[model samples]
Every structure is written in C-alpha cells, then in structure tokens.
Target: MKFLPIFLDSKAGPILLIGAGDPVRARLRLLLAAGARVRWHATDGDFAVAGLDAVAASRIERLETNPGAADLGAIVAVFCAGAGEIGVTVAARARASGLPVNVMDDPAHSSFIVPAIVDRGDVVVAVGTGGASPVVARRVRERIEALLPARIGDLAALIGRWRKAVHARIPDMPLRRRFWERVVDGPIGASVLAGRSDEAEDSLQAIADPSAYAGASAPGTVEGRVTLVGAGPGDPDLLTIKALRALQDADIVFYDELVSPEILDRARRDAVRIPVGRRVGKPGIGQDAINRLLIDAAKSGQRAVRLKGGDPFIFGRGGEEIEALREAGVACSVIPGITAGLGAAAESELPLTFRHEALRVTFLTAHKARDASSVDWSALTDRKMTVVVYMGTTAANAIRDGLLAAGRSPETPVGVFARATRPDAKSVVGTLDHLPALVREIDGGPAILVIGDVVSHSAPWRNASPTPLFHTFQMAAE
Candidate 1:
C-alpha cells in the first residue's frame, strides 16, 4: 500500500506546511476552518502564493534544511504541499525524521490519503478506497451523496431530539427492535426518504403501539388482505408483481420451509421477521398457533404477510389458513406462485399443455385421495388428459401402477422436478412405468409428478433465465 491513513490532532498549534500550490491552499483552508494556525514553507525564501490569508508569513522561510539543522521542535505533522521532485525530496526527509506527512498527488511518499467527505450541516459521510483509485472513490461518493435526501439531516436531527423519550417509552431491546421495525417499514422511513420529515415524524410517533395502527394506516393491513404469498418454487427473480408488492409493503413477515431465505431478505430490513417454518413429514409449527398469530397481528393493525413456497393454495395448506383468517373476520387473499409442475415444465422446456396434445389438465394430491376405491378408471385413462399429482413422490409407484392398470399407455412420459425454478433445480424424464423407482434414486426436493403425452414434446432441461411468474394466477374479482 502506497498510502497510510492516520488521524491528526487538529488542536496542534501552527500546522507547518511546505510549498505554496493549490493543494497547499486547500489544506490550509481546512485547517483554518477547523480553527488552526498555519505556517507556510517555501524553498525560494519568499512568499509565493498571492492574496493568501493573514497567517504570519515571516516564518514561511526557505526549505534548505542542512540535515543537522532539521528541527524536531513543535511541528505535529508536515505536508509537502508542492508538486514535482521538490515535494518528493521533502516528503522523503519528513518520513526519515518520523513525522506524519502528506505529499501532494504522490501516494508513494505520503503517510495518508485524504478521503472525499460530504458535509450537510451535522451530517457527514466520508468515502475512500484507500487511494487505490481516488477518482473511482470520488465518483462513488458523488452517487451515494446524491441518493441521500436533502431533508435527511433534518429527519436525523428530529429523531435525535426524541431519542430520550423513545428510550424511556420502550427500553427493552426486543420491544425497541419491534417498534423500530414498524416505524421504518410502515410510513416513517418512506416519508423521510421522500423528504417529508413532518409526515415521517407523525408516522414514527404513531408507533406508541404498532399493533394499534394495524388497520388501513398500516401497510398490507385491513381492507388489504393478509395474502399468504407463495414465493414460488425458488428463483427470486420469478416473483409475481402482487407478491413483490406485498413483500415491499409488508410490515411483518412470517415465512416457512421451502421458501428461499434470499427472498425473505428482500423485505424491508426493519420489517419484523418471524419464522413459522415447517418441513414436510416432520412435526411443524401447529396450524392453530399460526392461525392465531396471523389473526392477532391483523387485529393489532399491522400488515402481516405469511410467505410460503410454491403455490400457497397448492398443497401448501394455504386453504386452511385462509379459512382461519376468514373465520376471524380478517380480510384475506392469495397470490398463487409457480407450482412444482409448472416450474419443472418451464425449466425443462416442456409445456404442460401442447397444441392438441393435452386437451384437459388435472391437479391432484395422491397423499389423501378422497376416493381411492371410487376413482373412475375410465376417466383417468383418457388419452387426452394430463395429470399433475402434488406430493406424490413417496407414492409414485401406486400412481404409476394405477395408470397402467387403467388401460393407459405404459410408455406415458413422466417428468419429476426437484427444487423447480431455483438455480439448483433439476428434472428427470422417463416413463411412468419406471418413475416410482427413479423418484427414490434422486435426491428428494419439492417434487412434481407430471404424467402426460405432452411431456414428449419438451426438450431436455434448460436454464430459467428469469421472468415474472409468481403473480400468474388470475385474481379473484372482489
């Protein structure tokens, strides 16, 4: 590293500066503004800069230090404030004498490089790349400084004024964290970011109790449904617009298993995150607890979002939760996400329905068939029908055997997708006759079982180069 960084004691008297260039003047201005006396040094034995400030210039003498004559007296730091070889030579001398020094435009001889600093009243932001690239650092600083709202300083100052009151009102760390989450997510942060400190202050003050405002005043609350969104199989870029809006506006989030942690991270950092996650076939968060939590949050007047994986309404137990919300008189809605079937189809380049290949489609659950003994064999054996079985990976053999025994084609193409749509998604293509055994061989994920002739037309696995798919479901008209 050519340059080092150090903090200077601005209280040190009379900063000794050698050379009289623009760099020298700029450094002097900073010192003067910070209330420091400065003494300038020049090699010509005369003051060279014109119209300089009224600093005692008689002491600004020649820089011909004859080695032994070099004084280690009262100077705290040195600045070689001129250009070319002279500044370089002087910097070498200062370094040898163990004095902290800055050489103009020369990182090689400098002990420290100055950072680009932004000062907005009491708000200061400093940017530095440690002199690796000053121009790049400056440009980055400009971009960041531009993004800061002019009124942010006002908002910050306002918040600072009330810090004592807030601390007294909510001293517990958990409670304070929860309170701040709502204030930042609901309206205060937005208002401040938009340059409306008054509005931000009002919103922040309203958090005397966040749950008390969980009505329309709360985002994602009230007339707004607490739509448990299925972020769809996995790829974050595939989120539906409705889901995205819900995530962006959510005041609190309760996410679950199979849902991407990366997707949950998309929510506002200040939003209260609750993990009510569950795993398939393992005892999970009780349904009653989840239902009560959702209702309690809604009644408290907060935008409560329950984020899930795949289609919330598709084997995600979204139906039971919606029923619970409805019974509690909470307005509820659902945003369908890409089910495993569709995700696999898209990633594997297989259309669930092709031209004239699949005239009918059916989504079924093999886990709890209502009529295992009463299934219409003829109806299922129809050549034009495509069946998508949810959560059937474990019972794949029974499903495949039933289809074959029902006079269906033995070679009917079957596609099994594991972790569909995610970056690590994979698909297996084979016939229904061998699908049961194949399911066990593959590393299990959120599996989708597609049995249909349409699978024949799909090409081998392909990449899911992102698109909008989460909100693909038709919204029910109010």
Candidate 2:
C-alpha cells in the first residue's frame, strides 16, 4: 500500500484550506461534512457558499492573508485544490511542519490522498487506488455501498453504547472479542440493522452473562470449532460464499498444498496458516497429525479451518476428517466446493456425460501402476460410460493398457486437463491408445484424464486441427 489508510480526527483542529474554483468547493464541502472547522484562504478571493447551509457556512473563517506566511501552529492538516503554484508552496510548508497535506490530483506533493467514501452514519467504507485511478476507486466504493446494510451504522452505534458494559463483564480479551462477534453476527445485530434498535437493546440488556452469550462454556473460555472449507479447483472465485465466510472467521487455517495462494489470501490477515497436504512424491504431515492439529486447535478455544482443494467429500478425505473431529469431541461443519473434474470439464468445455454417446460417468483415482492394475476395468469398459481418472498422469500407460485389455476400444477419444480453471491451464486430446502420450504432452500433473467419446465434443478438440493422433492446446492466461 502506497498510503496507509486511516481515519484522522476531523475535530483535532482547524484545517488550512487554500484553493479556488469548483474542485476547491467540492473539497470544502467534504471537509465541512466531516465536522472540521476551516481556515479558508480562497486564492481567487471568491469565498462563495451558495449551496452550503448557514450553520456549516458559519464555521468557515475566510482570510485575505497569503496562507504561506500565516502561523501553522493551530492547523492540524492542509488541503489545496485548484490553488496552482500557491498549492504546491503550501504543501511544502505543511510537510516541513510535519502535518498531513493533500494537493488535489498531485500525489507527488501530497502527503495524503482523499479516498472515495461510502458513508452510513457511524459506519464508513473508504476505497482508494493510491492516486492511480479515481474512477476505479469510485466503482469499488459503489459495490461496497450496495452490499452494506442501510442501518449498519445504527448497529455499530448500538454496539458502541453497550461496549463498555460488555467489556467489563467479559474481561478476557479473546472472550470479549467473541462476545462482540456473537452480537454482530447474531440476532441482536440483525434486529438493529432491521430498524429494531429498541428490541435489540432489550435483548442485549437481558443477557445475564456475556461470556455465556459468546458461546463460552465458562466465564473466560470460548467455544471453538472446525470448519472444513473447499478451496475450489485453483480459482479463488469458484469458492462458495459460506466457504469464504469460514476463511474470514478462522483463527487458524490448516490448508492443503493444492489450495492456491490467491485463495489463502482471502483468509483473515492475522490468522495462522499451516500447510498439511501431501504432494505426489514429497512427504507431508500425515493425516493423523493433521487431525490431531485440528482437535488441538479447537480444544484450545481457537476456531480452526481445514481448507481442502475441491469439494471436501469428493475424494478429499473430508469424511475421514469429520470422523476424527467427532471422535475428539470437536464441533465441525462443512462447506462444499467445485471439484477438479467438474472444474476441468467446464473450463475445457468437455461434457462428462453426453446424450446417447455417453450415458454414465465414473470418477476414480489411479496414483500408481499397481493401483491402475487393481481397478475393475471391465465394468468401465462399457462404451457408454465416461471415465475420469484422478492422479492418472504417472500411471497413464498402465491406464491405457488396463482399459484396452478390458475390451474398451483403443480409438476412444480422451482428454488430459491440467491446472484446471487456473491462468496456466493446459489440455491435450487424443485417442485412448495414445492417452499416455497425450499426458506426456502436458507440462505438469495435478491433472485429470477423461476418457470416452464425450472428449471429442470438448472445445479443445473442436479447435484443434484434424490431426489423426493428438492435439495440444495451451490455454492463454486470463
């Protein structure tokens, strides 16, 4: 961040405003609305207040003296808009005095830049682009303004009123924080936001114990739990809303290696992150150890999140994690995500099941040659069944042999989609006999192999030249 975002106390002291014209007038309105007394030095001598109310206009003290030569002792900050050379001169003086100053549209001379703001009484959201693009900032501010509840400021004010009592009641810092979380995320806050502040006040006052209200079993101990969240096939946007919430609420996150850094970036900034996934060849903290970590985190009254790539239930060992949490008496919940196979199919425009040509779809894992050999390939030999093989890159040759020996046609179309839904995603398409070769054409693994005639209907296949054996398509970065 080029400039640290902070809300300066508008009531600190009178702001020195030296400028003229409509831009200066706009800045004047913003300063007055923020409740700051202004010491105005209108360079053009046009001290007009045409639209401002009497009370606000009365606070402005217009001066004829040049601001550069005036006393700087009482000024808290400085703002210069449409002031030309005089603005730059005043900016240098303010900087020398160690005061914050903003020269409109001039970041080089300004100590701070104003941001596009969304105001809702006590609640305010500021959007900035470090003086790069005001339009972009305004656009973001619009989105935030729409998402925020109209009375969210009322809810904040309500909390402010009750904060002292709650803080005294729940002296433990963590428990006190959780108590506020319960209030803001629960019915009391909802009531306030719904314009029922009186009812919300009564509800808050009726609570006998703030600690108990915060979900603590005792006065000082908070109740912690685990949430299994799906990271969703490499793309951060594919994450479900609930999954996003869990990440934000997590006190600590135990994430898989497959979870993208962009996805992890969405978690609470202060939350502790620990990687616990096993890579293809490299060892990881074992599953038993991972389960113990989750149990321990909850036992210590920390909200923990086990972040897995793709839907937790679909070959993600989510069921196993749930069992472990249950056995350890840890409360848990699950949020599903888009699995890799489905993500790959959508990204490549490949249908897992097509009309008539493919009536059934099967998803299985083949991490090793022995694993592929043990599969009941005969059942998968049906011409109408589409087969999706996970972790099949290394065992591609074995997969090809097993299906061919099981009476599956060697000419069946197949696709290898790698890094599905990511910027560097790639795909290779060919017949079943060349499935291993097709896999070899891809740059890397963490890929899935799709087999059956349905692969011929994919975008990659359609876009490819009419090659008899194979076609490769490296997807351009989005």
In order, the Cα lDDT scores of the candidates are 0.68, 0.92
Which stretch of 10 consecutive residues in model 1 shows the poorest summed lDDT? 468-477
Report the C-alpha lDDT of model 1 over 329-431, residue by residue, as the tens digit.
9887888887767776777677777667788888887763333334555577876888887777777767776788889887777777677776666566667
Worst 10 residues of 2 by lDDT: 66-75
Highest TM-score: give the candidate number.
2
In candidate 1, how many Å is residue 182 off? 13
Model 1 pairs whose backbones collide: 211-300, 214-301, 214-302, 215-301, 240-471
* Candidate 2 segments exceeding 4 Å error: 1-3, 67-74, 92-98
TM-score of 1: 0.56
